[model samples]
Target chain A: MQLTSPDFPRNAAHALHDAALQRALGNLKAGFPGKRAAAVARLPEFEALRDLGRDLKNHIIEHLDYYLEQFEASVQRQGGQVHWARDAEEARAIILGICQRAGAKTVTKGKSMVSEEIGLNEHLAAHGIEPIETDLGEYIIQLRGEHPSHIIAPAIHVNLDQVSDAFHQHHQQYGKHERQTEPRALMNEAREILRDKFLRADVGITGANFCIAETGQTVIVTNEGNGDLTQLLPRVHIAITSIEKVVPTLEDAATFIRLLARSATGQEISVYTTFSAGGRRAEDLDGPEEFHVVLLDNGRSQMVGGEQQDMLRCIRCSACMNHCPVYGAIGGHAYGWVYPGPMGSVLTPQLVGIEHAAHLPNASTFCGRCESVCPVRIPLPRLLRNWRAREFERHLTPQGYRFGLRAWAWLTRRPALYCGLTRLGARLLRWLGGRSRRIRSLPLAGGWSAWRDMPAPQGRTFQALWAERQRAAGMEGKR
Target chain B: MTESTKRAPAAGRRVALLATCLVDLFRPTVAFAAVKLLEDAGCHVEVPVQTCCGQPAFNSGDRADARALAEQLIAAFEGCDYVVGPSGSCIGMLRHYPELFEAGSAWQVRAAALADKSYELLAFLVDVCGVEQVDAHYAGCVTYHDSCSGLRELGVKAQPRKLLASVSGLQLKEMEEAEICCGFGGTFCIKYPEISNRMVSDKCASIVASGADTLLAGDLGCLLNIAGKLKREGSTIRVRHVAEVLAGVADEPAIGDGE
Candidate 1:
């Protein structure tokens, strides 16, 4: 939760050279995209559903207050409480207060990016309570004392050996000694260790994918059934989420559910799509006694009706990051925040000040792959551009790049000057190319020359040659 | 879309080449190749007095300059029946000019008009001109890199490939991850060189694994980037624009090649 976004360039350099991290990212490059493509192909209506999802989320964001109020009323009617947190600190304090009131010695958590954003684990640990991450990736990263490199795959930066090392270093507390190399053994060991904690935990915490206004039920979909146990087995259950996750009705939620799993992991539906309302009734065999929902509005309310409003439509399916080549290259930790990739590039600036996370928005190829794959159709490239515009307006851009851009723009306004300068520049470059016809390095563009040759410019500008040919042909045309 | 039996457009369609800044300064052969292809398609071609499409400024968040350049560009190409260009990235910037202006302003309307008339070379050839094949050929096995702008923005995926099929001896050996970016993102490569290097390095690796002796793409920026990386890696694979190959204009040295 420390703001390391300013160190993005350095972090990116480190990630690019980290052999183990690169090896781990290789699996991601091959794995998710193919599966998502096949899943999307199998569902003929996927594109139409994406449109529907976008429209539905747009509607929800527009009528956010109404649906959130309706959700709160629904939760109250179902014998549950809704707690509002204006920011991360407030959210952490509210959750911690609930844990303290419950006399919780330990609490189990499912994978929740909202929790990460709020820095809830450290907040709770700063007090006397211990929090256990139930999801496999989350548990691995928790043992390693690292943040989730990715939104969905928390420990995606960690390889199998790294996982073995994490468990080897940390699992001794559970009376387990051997370092397990196989994934199944690690999973089994984690499950055996977590089962005891799950049974003994006084409170359970989880992040909601959706909180439906109509039914007062919060939804979470997971493959390992960790969420169901984390919420069901504990004495008290708390669902922590951001305000934008609220949807008007189950049908609207269904439209997104159909899009989410396919976009995230290529599953038709995750193995467990658990929906929890208020506390259990007499007929319930296994359920919590107390239920609470905490909604965090950390700088989100200010984004309404702005250029970035579309970002609220994100379902955290992470389709943007998965499809992004930049994310593919450097992985997520380089982003140096809880959110990473295209969504992070846009949102990190909004959440943490743009000045703190300037590189997040500036470091993109604008390939539009993130926007292409977004389920809710967020225009991530455009949004990133919006940040660039803001950064430029605020003069947050680095001075040298800004000056080069400024000088380039100034000359573009003067046709004659631009033409003259380009003609001379072309000849200079051609001469620099000498015989090989490529410059190994450039004066100001060291970044480009550091890795690739600068292709030599043709001797003359196209307009100059065309005009000359036209004159030779006795064609009197406008110059 | 490539039904060659279908009739071509009425002859003498007043198509003006935008001659993107890259083609104007870096590789004028691409513009000439574009002129040859358009003239062969029964269209009248004219080179417009235009330079940069205002993308660098627009992308760098300097809309003031982007709009000023956009205004000048729109005025310069006012009467052309269609504004076509050699680079999809620049033409994509043209298509996006409307977004740079206010919603219903006069500048916005004109920007939209220019955007509507613009087309990338390959898409214009196949879709509008109805040209199925080009009367050109080369013996080398070649791979195509789908520059992101042309592929995603203008739907140029099949246009060049369809035309490439009609060449006499150019074998289109497809490469993996052909649709990925080569990382010459105008200002992006310059600002974040290391990341761009990583991306282009991966792209070069894929091009090598495809085992093609030649590389062709619609946009010169990506071609230059890939060619530069390939050359730096000491590979002999040649790079050229798709238009150059289609118009019989690739007789000169390959991009980034000499002596």
Candidate 2:
């Protein structure tokens, strides 16, 4: 997908006015955040579990090479093949090679963020193989010829009407005539239509929530059960994920899974927590004939031991974005990448270069909400600040902002100049306020004054008045 | 700050008031109100020479300037027993000062010392100074907006409400999503005003829905943003710093009251 991250401000401005997207975003207020809060309240040991998860992920990352080799060997022992891709280019090529070897005409996929990160669907389609998304949200967005706006809920940005419209426009070839607007009706339609593709597809690609090293198993947590169908029904099963997802054992994976459901959708356990040990055994009645695991490093290898290594602990639960006010305001599409919100802000810069995605980090208010609710307790605000520091050091910050910060810093360090400027600034602002005591427009701060009236300074700095009070009362003399 | 206002409680412990650049320039009355509250709680308060906590530079990734400012603040208030400020944001910045210096260095030790002594006005009043209620009176019902830094960073949520509960003739109505950010994130408001506007607009809607005639908060940045948007939307909600109400100096005028 083409990246619009450089135009974040433009995308955000346009998103704010888009009535449909706003209405869809409004539902987020009533959903995940409240449920997650309730779920966390129900489990008293949830915080302790989070700490364990963090430590486990840290240990796994520190020994990533050892565990990955162990995992590959285990997968081979279990009659499954594992492929490592250093980056997106190699990852896509490896997946395409698997499909071509299987002579796949059609491939069905469950929701996978790594797939989106690698731009897999478009690549596969361009190579003359049809890729079908079985997840209902994915299918709606797919029908609209759009990428998933949100990670878990792919078509969350599209409302019921938009779904009906997309389905009405695209479902004509399926011999379905009526536009289904009811939630149940739309689900049934999507289910019926995707059922055919799931059965007919030669290869299935799904994302792994966890890849257990000891058991050589991959896990996918879902509510719709589409992942089970996508992997089981196809002749070839391919689980595509990033390298940081590997865990040392099933027990460690269990700990992460416990945190994931509660943080992601507030469920004790998702309706379907399916695990694949390997391809079907000789006597197995139903399972794929060939099983393959594609591990994509992308930028994760460099990130493993860096300052942003904390980000690798993310279980993709999206608790950060679910509770983020900034995400609540603009929705996911404005982030202008496959990932959006807090996790996206950090990961996007790592995957995509910081120059192209500079606005992502600068856009936050550093409110600390994302950090507070993050399941793995990634210090998102600090990471975002680190990016800002990186930007400033690299001369990537906007010239006006850099100069303003420099002037602010210089004046602040010198109390005398700072006080003088503040006193004069107070007087200027108060006079600008005139009798109303407010300025509707400011000289250079149009971003603030354009929409909100700046409350005028109360006239004269506090120190000046305090000095007068001190002299009159002989207060400092007594001190 | 130690000499004039009220009698000694902790044997007249010297507390330095940071005065935060915003409270100093935009709302000096908040500093005075803070002084009155501190003095009434049987403590001495000192207004030291200060400009800012370097939050703008720190948050904008200007670490060199941020560290310079932190070093200066540590030096300026070293003589005082405690450093208190009316802003959660500025005081919160001080709490993270140790991160600016090299680990285990002398400067880091001083930064940690400075941070340990720093407290937001409301938290210090209730938590440290043992202030239960105020002699202040305000007749109107008010809903408080929890500034994010104070709420999350310093745990200033219940202290303000607990104190506000005792004010004579005051009704503390709570707004839904009061803990959410009002979008006045220092430079964040200026850089992303439209998004900030949307956030503040939602905040205003919640404030309006609470049916309170007035709004109070600890930080001036949030107050200015909310008050600015409240006025632009033509709402009659009077806005004031929480310190003003607690000190009973609210009679001066609501923020932006003159014209």
Candidate 3:
């Protein structure tokens, strides 16, 4: 995933000028948040259940080393292989090794963000292995050759017309009939096209929402049954997930499940929520022949035993993004990464150095909506602020801005100097804002005037008003 | 000062008001409004000589400078009954200070004390101050925007509405996506103007759909954002601080109007 966040003015200009993106963002009004409210309304103890979920995740993250060992043992006992990768390179290498050993012709994949994080598709294609996305949303993006915008709804940024064109172009080549532009029609076409690929594929890869330490089961929740087929039908099944996604017990997993669906899609449960423990056993009628789990610790281990450890408790529900004002307008593309939203803001800066993703932390309005909606109650705004702090302390910020901040901070600490400067600034503004009642353009504030007029500050500062009122009251008392 | 005055609320029950830098400078009416609201509910209100809540410093990555401000704030509000503020951002800063300061430092104990009692105005009114309503009246269809700090950090969602609903002549029309952010964000508007403008534009559109003549919110930063957009777009919809609306003292015409 790309880690660059373009300059504020440039990115803002792009977001404002993009009319199509505006229309795309309109769907958020009735999407995740609306569904979540209805889902929460169904349960009397949703808040209590959230507490349970948060506690469960906290416990797992705290005892992560213990749980990982336990999970590995259980997976081995059940005839599945568990691989630990210290970083993206090792993870990608291990996956390619699995595919090469199997002599895979084609691999069908369910929607897995970990795959995107590791750049698996690109890596596999470079190594001469064909990987096809079977999930409806993933398939749309695959045809268009674009990245997933939203975590859950991968093709959220793509409208029906664009999808219709993709299907019309790809369906005939894949020996499937072209379909109507409707969402259901698009899904049906993709499902029909991928059905045979799923059966013929030598290997299948997926992302786990949670890995149960108690049973060595990788739990996945999906509205469509593609995840089930991707893991079951293929001879070789590989689950790729971050090390943070571990839970102590099935009961703990159940607690998080209550919050996960409600937060992500506002549903009581997804259409198909399946749990696969290990490779196919003798009694199992339908299961993958070989199962492998790759637990990737890509800069996540460092987050433990620190102030940001709470962030690891996230269930990847995407609720924070849905309710976030900054994310709502720009869509996920502006984030320039796989994870886009408040969680992405903090996580991206850490995983890919703050210098590259500096604009992400600066993207927020510090509006607390993301934190309020976060299932784990992560203090997202503060975390983003922490990233900004690191950026400054490391001298990663632009030099001009650093000097300006120093000057401002110097002036702000002293009351007399601050008041004097503010008075001068106010008089200057009053002079500049004569008669028209606005500043059309200013040297320092061009970004502000670009979109809307900078409202002129009223002549007197608050200190002046307060002082005058006090003097008037004193004179009245003397009289 | 009489001992009865000091002892009535008790030492532990004494409340300090962190008049946010914005409240102290831009809108003191909101601060006085908060004071009246707290005092009316029997919590002694103390306006401490607090500087900025370290938000600008903290957000800008000047943690060392932010620590100075935090240390000063913790000292100023030390041994107070409750550390309350009209601004949600200030309350948020207060609550999160323990994590910033060293554990065994003098500032940490003060920060913890401050955090325990730190509540946004509405949350203090509803929870600590035990205020259900403020017996006020206003004639208009008004919609409320939940400010991020107040809604998420302080959990002050229903408190402001509960106060507003008791006003006799006030008619509340729920806005579509009322909980969404208006995107003021202090320096964020200037920093990311296009994104900010687009977000505020979306918020303004939702306010228009609710058809409420007036817009009210807990945080001034958001009100300023929405108000600026409304004013720039030449919309007549009025924006007011929720305290002013709840106080029932707003008789003047809204922005761009003569009373």
Worst 10 residues of 2 chain A by lDDT: A470-479
Candidate 3 whole-model C-alpha lDDT, 0 to 1: 0.79
lDDT of 1 by residue, A1-479 (tens): 78788898999999999999888888998999989999999999999999999999888889999999999999999999999999999999999999999999999999999999999999999998999999999998898899999999989999998889888888898889999999899899999999999999999999999999999999998999999999999999999999999999988888888999999999989899999999988898989999999999999999999989999999999888898889999999999999999999999999989999999888888898888889999999899999999999999989988998888888888888888888898889889998999999899888888888988987888888888876755443231
Q: Residue-wise lDDT of candidate 2 within B2-60, one digit each (tens)? A: 45434345557789998899989999999999988888887777788998888998999
Candidate 3, residue A57: how far the Cα is off, in Å: 1.9
User: Please, what is the whole-model Cα lDDT of each candidate in the order they appear?
Assistant: 0.90, 0.91, 0.79
Model 1 compared with the native: what TM-score?
0.98
- CAPRI verdict (incorrect, acceptable, medium, high) for model 2: medium
**Candidate 3, A1-479: lDDT as tens digits:** 55446554465567657787677777875677888888888999988887777777788888899999999988898899999999999999999999999999889898899899899999999999999998888988999998888899888888888889889987888776656777777777778878989999999999999898889999999988898889999889999999999887788788888889899998888888899989888999889889999999999999998867888988899999998878888888778877888998888877777777888888888877788778888888778877888889889877877787777666656656666666667668756766644566779877666656554554555555555655775676576
> In model 2, where do residues sit more than 4 Å from their true spots?
A475-479, B1-10
> Which ranking of candidates, highest DockQ first?
2, 1, 3
Two-way TM-score contest, 1 vs 3, winner:
1
Is candidate 2 or 3 superior in TM-score? 2
